[model samples]
Target: MAHLRDQPAGVDGITIDWDAPIRVSDGTVLRADVFRPTEPGDYPVILAMGPYGKGLHLADGYPANWRRMHEAYPEVAHGSTGRYQNWEMADPEKWVPDGYVCVRVDSRGSGRSPGFLDVLTALQARDLYECIEWAGQQEWSNGKVGLLGISYFAANQWQVAALRPPHLAAICVWEGFADHYREGARHGGIACEFVKGAQARQMFTVQYGMGSRGPTDRNTGRPVAGDVDLDDDVLRQNRRDLYAELLARPVNGEFYQERSADLSRIEVPLLSAGNWGGMGLHTRGNVEGFLAAGSELKWLEMHGDTHFNPFYNDRGLGLQKQFFGTFLKGEQNGWLDRPPVELLVRHPGERFEPRFEQEWPIARTEWTEFHLCPETMELRTSPGASGTLSYQPEHEDLRFRLPPAGHDREFTGPAAAKLRISSATADADLFLSLRLYDPQGTEVTFIGSNDPKVPIALGWLRASHRRLDTDRSEPYRPVHSHDSIELLVPGEPVDVDIEIWPTSIVVPAGYVLELGIGGRDYSNQGTEIENAMYPTTGVGPFIHTDPEDRPAEIFGGAVTLHFGPDVTSYLLLPAIPAP
Candidate 1:
């Protein structure tokens, strides 16, 4: 074949001799390193293609990740030789031990593969499609293929599955984001500051720039993948700098849509895994992708804690096996009849309680509203008399607390806040946080997506990027029409409705629901969680404060609150049913 390359030494399949790299219609050579049972027969193949060098062991590819993972998750070290372990994805040790054949290929410009790396482009999807067909034709392959991985590996799975490759059977997308524009890279019309800052260290260097950043084979002193000479200059040319480029253009528009996957075309059987604490990278997309994808046989499972742990834990692994057994093997595993939605509801003190429900925004949810009382800065059942609470440059932001519900309450899913606002400046930024305070007056912060130590749900905004997209606007989520901006008039309060991202929490009895409103972001303080694996500020995870993006002059302003006769402000919460 024109695109095929020479077979490497350790790549021959034990069960059936596999063909070397084969060319596809697109004229691109893709190399595959394979593992199969030492028997002469065909079997379903599990395929994964990404920049993490296939031949590279975790200890060599990313030593820090290896050290941290094993330190936190000792079970990862219990299996086979641990030759196939990688960061933030499936432990190949578990998969290869089973009957399934595992194949890993380096994406173009990464590992041994040669080319300029373009992260998650339409062309990348084309390459994956070819790889699927190539895998199916292998001598040991049963001509049926399934895909599975976390984050980058899983995100592209959605893209290629939409193409509906003939040999493709099923897929498990673990903690993958859905839309590149709205749900990822950019949030609330703003570039994700955390991803922007950590991209180079977290993704590029290991994947493309440096072949082996960890221990080397004592004999050759070379990487397990190839030559380890890949350095900084090569990294600069390897892939499009997603985090940096996103920072230059902080608003959503055509530039962001190029990489976003169109979910309407995806029709294969799919299982989406989500993490509750994965606020920064993986959380939103998992939730949105599950709801948006066109798959009829689809399931969503959400859990708490470090993003990757739950997926590989005993419980996570068991669920994945049952799901694959039913879908890929055509077995009558109970997965076919399992509930559509499953959640590991978290309580205080690191306790996780399991709950299985049919759908999200649970069926028995009570969509309730609490109005802002202007006079006393309190959240009341109804509006107060005519008056206003205004925050000038010298005044503090208005704070309000709602009376505790007699019984415990569960608030989950998306929430909304309606505000009547006037700006002294032409444009204004509004920061709102719906919080829960305990009986001891301790503010509760759940694990956020970006910062692991603090507790906060979804965050959102309107940079006045555009006027409201009237057709898509709803009480719970305000769909902004990023088409035009209407300048504000001083002293005139415009009815600006803000949509907060989804979150899940069970408020204990005697706990008060508090809402913090301000012209700028609130400080992430109080509780500091310990973790040697991830970066942390003084007390906890790093808080985002880019002077260029979050300057007080541009975002901070004196804003008024109206709960009495003159104005009304309130938050709409997705209240879940009590047990």
Candidate 2:
């Protein structure tokens, strides 16, 4: 029988269930921490499934992230004891009091759950689908389930929603990358070393094995992975090697498709939210899902600064509640009455101007062209003369600086560049870094997902994988079909279009735009800021350093850039005209 009760430890009238068992169709039991009202009644469910252990508290499992967020915004952890706060998962203390049941599940092999640990695979996605159905059928469930979380948690939504589970009602994809290959393992065609580093830092710590691989929380004597024990050998065999698996897939087709969000199949109402500073992994996927999803009822929201701050803080939490209230609770809260798009137009000094629009790349976007003059190293609109520049692949990058904008201009969308180049070898990797320098010549940077010193934008392409998926591409964003290798002919020029991911910045009058075309990653002279996850490098751990992926013999050779009226190499930028 449904009964209403209150706990002395919780807010008045709220009920909470810890370590609930949710068995999948295959009989594998996944552990979930369920937070709901004590009142015996059907309430909607908010589910977050990830490999991160459900037993791990945000304050304990990720102290650095927690500290950083609290220091920046104390109010996020203010109203509650925050004891139930798990990394990247909803705080039961917050949702339970609001009449919604929040369920956080540790996937197959993480936390106290026992099963094979195959991260982001189709098998894992299927397990999630079963979980949603299970939640819907629960005694306390109202039969409506919604998915919400960050990164791993959000990425799973894209995959599971594609299956179109009956009980699935809505989704909030916050800062999650969709394309496993392009946005994940390989950026353009280069393998990101960040994958392996991330595995070692995050996954290896809580991986389910013989003994708990996590630390015992100071507050709770139990280990972060739980106080469970298992046979070492069996545990080792059950966990899939996430890093090795990424290294094995060089091309995107079936394997990538299986893990990627199939937008065509995701018909549920969803809210796609991204961060302007999350250039590498997150922002692109948010925009892509919003633009291409099969969902007819969708909205887009974007912000800047700490990626972790917004989700838990009041500014973000309020918006999230509104999104879920209308969809999950069927609240008549005029959510559909406002503009469909929300943006935090960023300027220098971490200041963001709040704005609302009817569409992305607002209808009045002025597509501007900045032609490169290889000789003078100037970026201008009109062609000056034919020029050619060449450099050994291992040598310094060729940089061109554009004249400062005459007025305060907002360049706030996806960008692309056409390069006319020939290589001495059969293959060449073109690394493009789009940067902005202040009037005083200091590089303007922003906080990327993990890196604090990320540039304005970045892009990459291999001459071999330069074939564009014309139907899935736009002039400002060239989508490359990284399926087959179209190797370059020695000493012959080929036109390559590279897609620079979405960007949002309001450049002041005297700031200049700089473009760096290089054979390697761009580095800065500024002192690396010490951070929790990684020591500051020009880029974050997202650097491409896998030797097997980029052989010195094949990718290292002489390269050249040709530009003029005949060649017409230019950078396409989405410039929003001043209102």
Candidate 3:
């Protein structure tokens, strides 16, 4: 049963239906909150379904992110009361007045809804598809629905859209990853600790049945989790142990296949907005989604900023309205006349200039290779004399630097590194970092997705999972197959290809580019930001520090780099020419 309420005459002029029951195929009743215009007319719908509690206000649920976002861009809260602002979802106050109904639903077992909690599975996608159909049949709906949100909300859109829901018109995937195996739980076949931290701090806190333990919704003065509280043991039994499952399944098997999206099956209009700073998690998905999706009408937009900033800022909001207005409202807004790709060209001092393009990897990209010379510790155009270098995997890092640029140069798009190496142990893990230094030799870092300081690009790979999917491999991007592992033979050198996520940066005449390779995560002597949830180091929270995943006996051994005429290692870059 829904409890309908009309706003006061002077208030925002929007009506709300709280705790609306949306029955799915299995007779499970999900809960949603619908915000519609008070004028009583049919309008297009913008629906968002996720595990985050719909009633948990942004300030209450994620205080650090909320404060930092507002402080950086005050315009985010300029036009509305900020009461309906939830984590990563659209604001009802902004959408209702623009002739669009905003629908925020609590996924199966979160918030006011009750069921088994399983995040990012086929079951969740089916529930979303049913919710879309339900929204299309509403009396106040104009029979058109659009999907929009950030991170988790955006990631699921790729899965549900593949089902080809009749009412889903368009989707704007803002900083979302599509592959669960590569971008979600593991990177380069090494277990990442991000999922464990996120599950504990973000999901379990607001899970359904928290009752008195959960925060109260400021607007309704009721518990955000639900009306009844369950014991700790019962709550544990209701939800799947996501971290445990990831550790148990180390390869790309049936477990990961069910969570990853089938990009070829998605045929709806798509606008994938990715961030240059989101190297580890968000960048790869957006670029891959834009290229692999079967949609005839698709566009890609890349920007440089904090993950949450660009989605709510004026520039981001404008692009969203222009896209949704043309698709859902049947308006001739000239959106289709624009190019299919938009890039925010990055320059020194955190500046970005927007440019439109015809395709990704910019059709005119010059694929340049910088050969690694171990003898001189430099990246040169030609291979150097045979030399060998060894370092302790657990304690030391090896760096190779390129000479100062003679003129301004721009490197934009995907990158790859091919290395020939040997290990004293059976296996080893490799971490790569591309860094920039100014004329004074000071490192230049950018604001990453979750951290305040980040490198130009980062990549990781466990030596054993070095097999490539040759069919999908490109000159600039190397795709890895994590189905099985092939341990290395002691003192034997093998060639391995590593894929560095997409990035964009302009280097001035005196600036230098350096590549760092090590067996551990990259870090520098920088102060952590006050509002960052994790230490604002180079990699943020996407770290691979699990001892069980990288045992001391196998991974923490002497690693050797062999350079010779027969075994030449090099870095592949996508250098864009000045137009």
User: How good is model 3 by TM-score?
Assistant: 0.98
lDDT per residue for candidate 2 within 1-579, as digits (tens), equals 122122343444555565578888788888777778877889999999887777667876677778878888989877688877888877777777788999888888876567887788888899899999989999999999999999889888989999899999999999988898888878887777776877666765676653455765343345656566666677668787766876787777787787887888899999988987776687889888888889989999988876688899898888888889999999988887868799898887788998999998678889998888776888878775787888876678888898886799788888999989998888988889888889999888876666666788888888898999999888888999899888888889999999998888898999987899988876675344424666556576677767788787888888988776788788888889887
* lDDT of the structure predicted as candidate 1: 0.66
Q: What number of clashing residue pairs does each candidate have, in the order they appear?
A: 15, 0, 0
Poorest 10 consecutive residues by lDDT, candidate 1: 11-20
Tens digits of lDDT, candidate 3, 371-436: 999878998889987988888877989999988978998999999999998999999899999999
**What lDDT would each prediction earn against the true structure?**
0.66, 0.81, 0.89
Can you tell me which runs of candidate 3 are displaced by over 4 Å? 1-10
Q: Between the candidate structures 2 and 3, which one is better when assessed by lDDT?
A: 3
The model with the greater TM-score, 1 or 2, is 2
**Local error of candidate 2 at 386, Å?**
1.5
Q: Give the TM-score of each candidate.
A: 0.86, 0.94, 0.98
Runs of candidate 2 with Cα error greater than 4 angstroms are: 1-14, 217-221, 226-233, 525-531
Give the root-mean-square deviation of each candidate in angstroms: 4.4, 3.0, 1.5
Q: List, residue by residue over 1-579, the lDDT tens digit for candidate 1.
A: 233333333332233122236465666565566667665567777788886655556566556546655677777567555654655556655765566777776777665565676677787788888888888887777788888888778888888888899988888888777777656665555445655544554445545446566334332334433444666676677677776676677666666665667777788888988877665456767777787789998888887766556766677788877877776667797887888888777666556678888987577878888888766667777876677667753235567788887887877776888877776666556666667678988877665434445454545554465356788676776767554546566566777777676667788889887777765445555444433434542212223445565556655556665444655478888887766
Clashing pairs in 2: none
